[model samples]
Structures are given as C-alpha cells and as structure tokens.
Target: MARTLKEATLTTRNARAKLGEGLHWRGIDADTHLGYRKGKRGGVWLVRWRVAEGHYHRDKLGAADDAITEGTLDFNAAVRAARERVEAVRREERAKADGVVHSVRSAVLAYSEMRDARLRERTGSEALRTASSSALERYVTGRVAGGNMEAREAAPIADVPLHDLTEAQLSEWRDALPPTLKASTRRHISADLRAALNMAYRLHRTKLPASFPMTVTEGLHISRKASAEAGEATARENQILPDSKIGEIITAARDVDAAGSWGGDLYRMIIVLAATGARFSQVARLTVRDVQADRSRLMVPASRKGQGSKPEATPVPVGADVLAALAPAIRGRAGGDLLLTRPKMMREPGQLKWVAVGQRPWGMAARLVEPWAEIRKAANLADDVVPYALRHSSIVRGIRAGLPLRLVAALHDTSIAMIERHYGRWIADGLDDLAAAAVVPLVPA
Candidate 1:
C-alpha cells in the first residue's frame, strides 16, 4: 500500500535542499505519511501515522538520502519502511481492542501481531537475540500479516468463539496437534493458544457472554507430569545444576579465560547468571548503570511481551559479593556502556596477527554456543546442562532454603504456577521443616 504523490521531487538531493527547515510530507496509501525534515546540510526521514481519530504518533524512519550516508533512505524505501511501522501500529491496536474477538483464529492473529510488534520495540535494531514473541508471529505476518502457519496448524477449532468455546473443545485441540511436532513444541503452541484466549477474555470481559470461555479459568496447560513421561520437557531434572557443580562450572569458566577466548566476558556473565537467577537474554542486555554496585542490585528489564516498549527495570537484590565480582567490568565505564563486551578483533593490512581492538557486546544467544561448548567440556558438565542451569540451580536453592514458591517465582520473574509445576516436587522434600513449625504451635509453644 504505497502512494507516492510527491515522491518525485523528494527523491533528489537538489530539490530537497530548496525546502525550509520543517517536515515535508507525502501520503502513503492514504493512512501513512512519509515525511522529510528539511535542513541546510542533511535531514531525517519520518513516518506519521494516525491510527484512530485524534490520536497520532510519529517516529524517525531514517536519514533523508541527501548524501550517500548510513541510515539514509530513498523516497521508495521511505514508503516501504513507513508501511511497516503503519502495519505494526494497526496490529497493536487490533490486539488490545476494547471489543471481544469473534473467533480463536482472530484472537491468535491479534496476539501474534501484538507480540511481533512488541518484539521489534523491545530489541530495537539490535536483531532479536531472544525473541519475546514466538515464530508464530513470523508465520502470521508472512501470511498477509495474519494468515500464515497459525491458520494451518491451529485451524478447524480456531473458528470457535470465546463464549462458545468449551474446555472439551480446547482440550481436544491441544491433544490433536500433529504427532510429527515434538512434545515440547506441542506444549509451547498450546501455551500460546491458551494465552491468546485468556488475553481476549481479560481484555473484553464485560462484552463477552456470561458463560465466557470455560478454558480461561483452568487454561489448556496439560499436566507437566504427563508431558515429562512423554519425554523432551523443556524443564527437566538434568536442567538443574547442583551447588557443588555450579562452583565447578565457574572454576572451569575461569580456566577457559586462561586461553583468552572469553576474558572477563563469560566470567562476569556467569557471575550475574548465578547470583540473580535471571535469563541469559536479560543478563546479556544489562548496561553499566544497570549494575548498581552501590545498591548491590541488578535491575532486570521488565519484559516488553504484550506492549510496544519495555516497561522498566525490575530491581532484584543480589549479594554484595556478586557486585564485588562485577567490579572490573563496572569500574570507570560510562553509565550507558554495556556491562560485558567482547573486545573487537582486527588484523592490520598484510599482518598475520589479529589484534584485539575496541569492544562489542555479547549479542545473540547463538553467539554464546561456541564459547559455552568449550567451557562445558572444561567443566565436564553433562550434555543436558546449559547456561540456563544457573537459573534452575538458584530456584532449587531458594526452595531448599525454605523460601515460598510464590516468593521464588517473583524473584525469578515467573508465575507461581510455573514454580509449582516444575519445582513442586522439591517442595515436598522440605515439608518436614515446614510441618515441624506447625506441630509445636498446635501443642502450645
């Protein structure tokens, strides 16, 4: 949907120079405006979208193609990028609409659109290292931004409206997904579907019929015990590292450092991971200011899952010893600097030596795979153990220390239901101490 009425003049550098220092506008498909801010030397391209009456938002798309420069955009390219921003805004509006969704298909579409938009907002231009949203959003976007694989896999039952949808119908849908899909894959998709339906009800409760969806109360979560027996569960016994094993792994990370493969990058990352029990994705995104060495806290970024932007950093208390470990990375760095960076490597012309130059962040999760493999071998860790094991190990420690599951979930930024499902078995192991407290009270302390 591109409309280039005034694009001919805006395309050339000579023509743009003549304009005054203000926004020059050209409509794109009647809904969006591809704008250029005229300047003496150079200017930026912008997109203005009016999603609904009386409400509009404008964002910088890139630089105007006045000179051959990075981030500069041509007239045609401006239209293309403008349309993407327009589509994203519209999808967000549709996803969180005040009205009820008529069908599961539409609900899924809305949720997918909302997540994809939010993912881009969350990661900005860094390229999604860890996508807050799932691949279903990609499928939905490719399929007319709504029609791709979501319709293919979750079809037939997707036509049922929320009020009309029953527990049996939802259960059947979950149970009947193709056998070719792995058990974990099936679980993830069902979890997504469950979220979509529940979101719809949560958003438009009053508008829905009195019955609403019965599935909303309990959700489509198949018993974790049942799934574990089926095998390939995401959270499993092997995922949890023991206290002694964690120390061994850290010691091994330091061993890897002697080779200069990771330097302080992996070492510091492991320290935060072990201390905070935060996600690898979260730890990788921390800035120097996020360190807060004085307060002895790591402000974890609140997820931008459903919304268009990051809400705020969640302050999780950490031991002062953890901050002491991070002292090298934090000392004298700018507040906005990345807490951990892989020093940039370069080879001068005609030189055989590759010299370490400046620095770069440990970006994508995939980037860690190679380094992790080497460290894993050094540590003699099991095949199933991974960076995520730090989180599991920490959660298990909290439970064993007699901290409530609800408290553990909050500390780790997850739901109590998740803690109960994955780690509840350990709760029983600690019941003796918990029961002992209750026994003396009843006998009159």
Candidate 2:
C-alpha cells in the first residue's frame, strides 16, 4: 500500500513509546514520493521531498510547531525540508559519481599523479618517474584495493559509510588488524587512511562526518620492549652488539679472502658501519668524492628515508679503523670514481664493457654484515648479534665513554635527540655510577 500521512496517523497513535517513529511515517507524502528522515532526540525535525523531473531543482520549508511530536509536518514545511535534503544528496551523489567516472582508486593515486606531473615538469629521470608510478600502484593495491576486498568479505575499512559509522565501528576495524603487526605498523596504516580522507575532504571529493577515530598523536599503543623471559625484545635491544664481539667479527673478516670472484670490500663496509653510525644505505651510496681525507670527514650525500630528493652532505669523521679497512679496497677498485666497484663481467663484439657500482644503494649493508655474522656463528658468538648491532654498539660505547650526546650524534651524522631517545640507558648508567662515586663518607664522623 502507498504510504500517506493518513495511514501514518494511525500507526503514530499505536506507537506511543516512539512518537518520533509515528511522525517519521506521517512525514511521508505519497503523491510526491521521495524520502523520509526522522530525528527528535536533539530537536524534532522531519523532511520529505521529490526530485523535479528532468531538472536539478527542489522546494522545501520548515515546520512552525515548536514542540513537534507525533503530529505530521504541514504540507509546505514537509516540502521545504524534503527539498533541501534531496538537493544536498544530489550534489553529494554527483561528486561521488564523478570520482567513480574518473577511476580514482584513492586520494594517494590522485596525489601521485600530480606529483609525477610536477617531476616531469622538472625534467626528472624517466626511471624515477617509472619508480614513482610503481610505488603508487603498490600503495593503492596493498592499502586501498585491499581494504575494499576486506569490506566485501564483511571486513569493511576503506568503504565505511562515514556519515553512519560511529567511533565504535572504527575502533572495531582497528582491532581486527593482524595482531602480529607491530603497534607502529597499525599506527602507520591508520595515518595513511586518515590522510586519504583528509585529502578527499580538502578536494571536496567526500565529506568526513567527524574527526578521524584513530589519531597518531594520542591514546594509541606505544610498543613496549619485551621482557627477557618472554623471548621478545625491542628493536634497540636486538640492534646492539657488544664492542668485544664487533672486534672479533672484524678480526675474522680480515682473514676471509674475496672468494676469487667477489671482492673483500665487504670487510671495509662492515668496519665503516661499526666505526661510524652510518646507516646501510648511506654506506652503499658512498662515492670516492664524498670522502674528504684532508678534512678527515666522510660527506654523506644522501639518505634512504628522508624528506628531500637530493640529500645535503652530513659530515662524519673517519676513524683509524674505518680508514685502514677502506684503503686496500679503494686502491684496487675497478671503477676509478666508485668507493666500491664491481669488475666488468663481459664485453659485446662492438660494445665497450666497463666496471661500475650500482648507485641505488639497497642491500649493501646487509650483504657486508652477513659474512661477519657467519664468522660469529662459527666462533660461537651470542645469537643476538645483527648487522645493526654495530650501530647500537657505537652509540652505547660513546655514551659510556662520557661523550656528549650532541658531539656523538654529530660524529654519527644524526640528531642528538634520536641518540638520547634510543640509547638513553647507556647515559643513565653513567649518571648512576657518577652518583655512587660522589657519595663519600664524612671525614669527622
């Protein structure tokens, strides 16, 4: 049966517990069949409207009843509120349909497209452009596309109806993520999702009904270091190797021959990592020109994870061990320009073959450290030894040696705040020792 105010009036009388429900029904006008909305908790208001044929137009008005209850809206008032909602919905739908038509998977994809265009304008490398496109594709597929799939399987995350979803719904979705993922990882995903929404809101692509339920700043998990008994450890704990073990590894490294084909340059790389707190990627990208023997500094020209495209030089002092390790490899390097070089494998009939090192410094650190770890295993060293252990060892020793955090960080080409945050235990121990030493017995007692 076609719903009308007459039909709804009867239902309203019977539905005494919910006067709003009865008014919700009564608000509908069958002649101009449109839609109904009911809410009285805040203030009683109802809307009903019909879209005018073949045009984007709606007419509406407000009800005069101050104490609106189970009674229906006057015809004019019903028409007015109905018209406004219908118009608002139409605009929202049009915008959404436009995005669908444009095939925008996520705001990241759109932003990436704009970024690429800017890069192209700047005459950036074709290879870099290709990599950026690949990055965007991967990000979209892994996050946005994956979220959509989850939603289809009743694990809706990305496609959440923002208007309808409550804070509880968002919290449940966050909880449903893989428990194995580190809390940091969960925070990252939440941040990325929030970014997508924020971008959409900015572009008028979609409305975020409220502030994001997950905030990066507050009330999120800060992963605690695992207890020794629990067999879990923080990244900091795992990254620290004893200085004695580092010495042993270096000694073992000195004996290992460059397996006839592969170079022994790996030893030098290991020594550099141990001496300076230079990250793996920074070590890999080291060019001969980046070294300043006169100034006794190694200029790091790039960072793997940072804001800028071309990194500024970070001056790190070259230690005696680092210099000694680098000398033999630098002398015999296949490429005159490269700090670490690979020998030419083959030459085509008419083409010149030349020795070169890969500029893309990816796994150089890992490759170099693996051999020392193997040596450690052979010599029965502790199981906690890792490539990054060298870095942690340097920081811990520097703090123990009473090196100021500022100078230590400058030596390592990193922020003092970072060193203090991650390796503050070493400094705290020194303070404790100093405090104990200061406690002398009273002479006159």
Candidate 3:
C-alpha cells in the first residue's frame, strides 16, 4: 500500500506532526518514499527507494531536530535528498548488473576475503596465506611490507582504479621496488598479483577492460635483466657439507651439549637431519609413533610441500646411525609424545631458581635456525650454512655414493628433474663408475 501526501497540507506543522515513527509518505513515484523514524536522537528522516525489482535501499537524509549535529531536514530538503538518493541507487544497481565501475581495491578485497575463507575451511598452510597476503599488502594495499613486517607506506598504484590500471603504470610500480629484492621474490610477487586479478575476474564475473594487463611478465623480464646488470640476479647455490665438515659440526654440537648451555637433543636433531634428509618442519613435528619398530624407516607426515590436494603419509628410510641418534630422545616416551621438545621458562622463582617448563601444544619447538648459528661458527663452517644444508649434504652424498637418481628423488620427496638441475654435476661425477662397470673400450679390443 502507498501513502500519498497532498501538496497543500504538507506546508503545515500538522502535516509534519503526522510523520511519526514507521510512517512513510509517497513522493513522485510509488517506489520512492520519504519516511520518518523516532531514534535515540529525537527524530530522523529516512529515504527508501527501490533500485531494482523487489530490492529496496534506504538512507538517512538528516535529523528532524536542529540540535542533532547532522543537520535538520525540512520537507523540501528531505524530498530533494530522497530523489537524489534514488538516482544514485539506480546508478549503483546498473553498475553492479553491468559489472563496471568497481574499484581495484574493492575487487582485491573481495578476492582476499574469498581466499581467506577457503583457506580456513580447507585448513590450508600458512605459506599460501602468506603469498596471497604479501601481494595484497605490497601491491593492493600499497604497503611496502612482507616477510612478517609491519606496513610502512602505501605503494603508488594502491588507489588506482581497476579499469584504469595500465601496464605502463604497473611497470613503473614494479621498477620502484627495492633493488635488494631478489629476482625470484619479484617474480613471486608479480605472480601473486596476477593470481589475485584472475580470482577477482572469476569470482566477480566482472567485465574487465580487454586492454587490462594482469600479468607483469614483460616488466619482470626487464627487471631481471637490470638485476643481472647490477650483479643481483645470481642464483643461490645450496651449501653442501663434506663428510669431514659434518664430523666437525657434529663434534661442535656434542661439545655444546656437554656444556649444558643447551640440551643434547639439538645434536640428535642435527644427526637425524644429516642422516635422513628430511625438512626441518617435518622433523620438528615427529613423534615416537612416527618411527617404525624396525628402526630402518620413519614416516614423514604430510606438510605444506608434500601435501597436495589429497594428503597422505610419506615413509623415509633411515640409516642405523640415524635410528641410534633418535633413540635417546624417544626413550621411555609415550607413542604420542613429540620426539624433540625444548625447555621453556615457566616462571622466575626468587631470582635464584627459575621454574622450567617443557612442551605444550602451542609452545615453541626447537625448529628455528638461529640456535645452529653458534654451532656453525664454532665448527668454522661458512656463515651462510643453514639447517637446510644438512639436507643438501645428504642428497649430494647419496648421489656421489652412486644411489639411483629415482631412488634419491624418492628418498628426499623431490623430483628427478629437480635433482638433475641442482645436483646434476655432482651426479655426473659418479657417471665414470657406471661407465667403468657397464662399458668396455671397443677400440682397444
């Protein structure tokens, strides 16, 4: 039902008095209404307009009282505001239906919200969240921040309209990144931006300009050349420790353990990592139950890297020495107990005796690489030597020991192509043995 006001009666206070809470007076059309409501601040004028079929939108025009800082709305002003609002609503509805005029910020935010919801529902790894968030923070939000740091300032293109965004503008922004950022990092950030735009296009079903360039491939290629010229494009090689160096590191770890400054568990962890070639994350999450009774193999649980769409357990074969090294930590522990646990400071007791705490569900594990710095320094290893070096050392040693390429890849949960790419030369060093055993000189015979 529509309530229409007579133009003659609207000029009196009597007509104004009739406009009470939940009362609406019809304006030029049935779909548009000038309404009144009693609120905490005396009275408020509201305009309700139907932008589409059965879809009504409302907006507060102003307060009825002058004392309300928002300003007083007389009948004429209210009607004018209502008409304007109606026009605005129609424009917005049209834009939404036509998939035009959405800002880049709006689309990116929509994509981010959708991505976060999916991650939460699927229990996705933090790395995926980090990659997406990095793109949003660095480019969309215009913040020059990533790697778990606070956002400092906005990027140049942060506020640019999505439809108006151009490849030239993006190339300029990409070039402005800190020279210290690696080529790989630049490529990753670019890839993330492209992914966000693709997701936005798919999810919003919006018609982006055909000229819109989502990928920054050309810009990245140019940047890579620039980086090479600046000597910043060199690929980092993994540090592989020799047997003698490993022995020295182990000796230093044992010395540190004997001093009781840290626990013996640290050395055991190093031994296991060196022997099994498992990632730090996988090894850190190990429990007694993960180890097989035969002590020849251990099950590496599906982590972010190994776990794809469908996750399952991966079994890694271990040497006898690796089993012996892990024995001290797992001895007398329940099957479910963590293999590696770090002592924590629970409370300070009278300055002399500090209460020590063990493992809790959310407590810090001995997974960080910082603790190994001292050991590395003491062992006179390279400054760049990290915990992952042990895994590389294992892989290289296995290849040198004439382990089949496929077997080595299986052992390390990696691909044959990856092994060939990084450790191919080392793998080639052992090819002579294969030649000596399998082939004979045809010319001499």
lDDT of 3 by residue, 1-445 (tens): 4334543223334565555444444455777777766544355677777756777777888776524435677667777888877765654454467655666566666667666665544332343353466467765565545687876666767666555556777788777777777775676666566655655556544444443443433433444454555554221354777888888888888786666444667677677677778777567667888888495888876554522352355678877877887777778889988776654545565576644465422122233456687788889877877777888888888888888998888777777987886676777778877677887678954
Candidate with top lDDT is 1
Say which prediction, candidate 2 or candidate 3, comes out ahead on TM-score.
Answer: 3
Question: Per-residue lDDT for 230 in model 1?
Answer: 79
RMSD of 1: 21.4
The C-alpha local distance difference test score for the whole of candidate 3 amounts to 0.65
Candidate 2 residue lDDT tens string, 1-445: 3333443331222333344532433434433332233344322334444454333233333432434544545444555666556645755565466454222245546655665575454332343343444433443334334634431232453344433334565566567767776665555554444444445556743443234334312322333432323444433565666677778777666555353233555566667777776776567667777666678777865464433354376787777657666776556445425575433335556878543333322233334555666666754667666667777787777777777788777666667776766677778987787788899888986
lDDT of 1 by residue, 86-109 (tens): 765664455446654467767777
Relative to the true structure, candidate 2 reaches a TM of 0.58
Top TM-score prediction, candidate number: 3
Whole-model lDDT values for every prediction: 0.71, 0.53, 0.65
For model 3 the local lDDT of residue 34 reads 76
